[model samples]
Target: MAITDIPEYAHLTDADIEALGQELDAIRRDVENDRGERDATYIRNSIRFQRGLELSGRALLFGSGNRKIWALGAGVLGVSKIVENMELGHNIMHGQWDWMNDPEVHSTGWEWDNTGPSAHWKHTHNYIHHKYTNVLGMDDDVGYGLIRVTRDQRWKPFYLGNIAYNTLLMLFFQYGVAVQHLELGRVAAGRHPNPDAFKQDLRDVGMKIGRQVGKDYVVYPALVGAVTRSRKTWLRAITATLAANTIRNIWTNAVIFCGHFPDGAEKFTRQDLEDESQAHWYLRQMLGSANFDSGKTLAFMSGNLSYQIEHHLFPDLPSNRYAEIAVRVRALCDKYDLPYTTGPFLLQYAKAWRTIAKLSLPNKYLKGTVDDAPETASELRFKTDPDQRLTATVDPATGRRTGLRTAIGKLRRRRSPVPAIAGQRQAKDVRAA
Candidate 1:
């Protein structure tokens, strides 16, 4: 459903929206001023950890005659690759650490160890994806222009095979990301304005793929073969690299898919973007994001994008600060009666796959969908861990949330814009109507 069509929030005027935006901006300013040695130390120390893992993995790969050792090496190497892509590379390329003023760590000077060109990724991801965010049709990352994610998509018979196609895409996910700047869908649909420009972009992407393939499959493996002198050394080396890459690719696909496609995340129409105020934009960001209520391992693996809403609200803020920022964001949401979409890592991970499988069928057109979600009983209520990271649903009468809600009620009893009597009467009136 269209964003502006939501009558619930119509009570908030443009001035009220702007006031809410100022509160959010205050958080950004406070964080920006406070960033110092600790933030820099985190990034630098993380890079060392990643490099150490890669070196150890390659050293073990040289001795992969033992199947167990090879598996261990591949797992280690996969973690290295994951962190580089997830934490160090992706965040640096977002200009997150640029405030440190170290050229080596600067966005302009840093290049990632991936087939996807850093420049192109910044364009497609940092600029486009973050800017348009979850606005339907505008963001290319919406199913990467392939799988129909929402009911708004015009369906066809070909979508019947999307389950298979999405699986294949995950296996070769890096390759898909590498060529994303090419916008092949537009070219195929004859929407591209200049074929020559697109061809040049494709050629650049081709060179990137060649360099990546050679480094992983040929050069590294050959170095191992020379040291080991086993006839099967080159083969084992190549297999190990492939294994690591596959692990990294699968993880990247999973974490990203969970961020937006998981159960309660919402999407917006073009009209929503056009008429949006700063508060409206923030609201969209909150609705459009789904977070993982996971532990540290998945958090590091996702560059703390596990707090996807926080990332949307403050894209350039240090990721480590997301945990702290989440508390404030949630308080604000609760104050304004907004839904915070999140679940355990496993739950969101599975929900995203379920969304893909469900969308593979023709969208049943008999009923209206609201805010890009079906009118069925799939709405999620979030509950948080003690740290208040969204993980499950709060029963209205129990546990940590009950304590928090009691506090919230005490606070709101004084400041609530609407009277308690009117609120209940309104609810009853709607039911009677």
Candidate 2:
């Protein structure tokens, strides 16, 4: 789409720009001075985090009472992890951990880690993801074997299976990432010889399913009954686990999905990145990344404001600084002629799903289909279908459609003065329709 064709939403005027600058300055001050430290918001967020930790601890200590109860606790815990992954893990990864520096600024196990804020997610996310947001060859965010995250894969004939597999895995996310990462480790170590590197995923996912069955069938019930006959503690543990796991998985999946699978994000091949500069890569991270609302309780409970766009741009910046930089980012985008895309989180999430839907459909372009196939009658039929064709029939004199009843009526019923045709012109109305 052309730049001129972009629908005019709203543009920042010089005055608007100046006001935003002042706002950013004030926010920066509040951040540096920690003026909001004791504010109700801070206290509230602290309480939520503490409660999550406490509940998760309870779940870990005791097993759930029955099979059904255990599943419930596990689901809830997954959701909590989702929230924490976005709010807490993302925030700390973004270095938002400095909001309260009582915790040391160590890189190893800081609050910034995605999976407990360790260095692995940091390296994989910062160095790899940001550096190569959508470039298939380098960015793990895309071709992570079983976890294909974008529609660009559909064009390949072989990618049909990958798309189907990814769909199911997205619903069961925790296992997906864990298994994918494990497979990635094996492939990186030169342990797998399959050219497409799919055997590793099969190996990891199979092992995980086996382990889950082992735990559910043998380990959990046995351990719970053996430890105590009291079912109440088990019930509490069951609920707690479900709560934690549910939050974690949902939050992580949502954040990751929103980052690249929606509007304003690009899917590039190795060729697209070959000529791109470092600044170009940085812009992709800024424009391609998105943000979502953590909601009142959710933000406090989860730590999602970290390493978002600004963090991607400047990894050293603490996570809490994200909200503060938003206004400044708007100004920067205007000044630099960049597109800064922001919206409510869930809305963008729907956009991601829509993107997937569009890509997953049979339409070639939407499916990210790379067409190398020889054209056939069926292909031509879809392409030339009248419903999809573009047609324009217009009046010869005025370049307007005259065949419509309304057009003819307008021509005859108009009270306005009409211009006369030349001497050679016919008296009849000329219809190009």
Best by lDDT: 1
lDDT of 1 by residue, 1-433 (tens): 4344221222234554566588899989999999999999999999999999999999898988778988998999988999999998888888889999999789998778789888889999999998888677788987788887776667788777778888888888888889889998788899999999888888888888899999898899999889889758668888989999999989888889889888657666676776667777776677678899967777888999999999988988988889999999888766544567788888898888877777776667433343324311111111112333222234556432222233224334545657977888999999999
On the 0 to 100 scale, the lDDT of residue 95 in model 2 is 50
TM-score of each predicted structure versus truth = 0.84, 0.57
Each candidate's number of clashing pairs is 1, 53
Query: Against the unseen true structure, what C-alpha lDDT does each candidate score?
Result: 0.77, 0.49
Query: Residue 131, candidate 1: how far off, in angstroms?
Result: 0.9
Candidate 2 lDDT: 0.49
Candidate 2 lDDT trough over 10 residues, lowest sum: 1-10
Task: In model 1, state the lDDT of residue 214.
Answer: 91
- The alpha-carbon deviation from the true structure for residue 329 of candidate 1, after best TM-score superposition, in angstroms, is 0.6
For candidate 2, lDDT tens digit of each residue in 154-180? 344444454565555555565655554
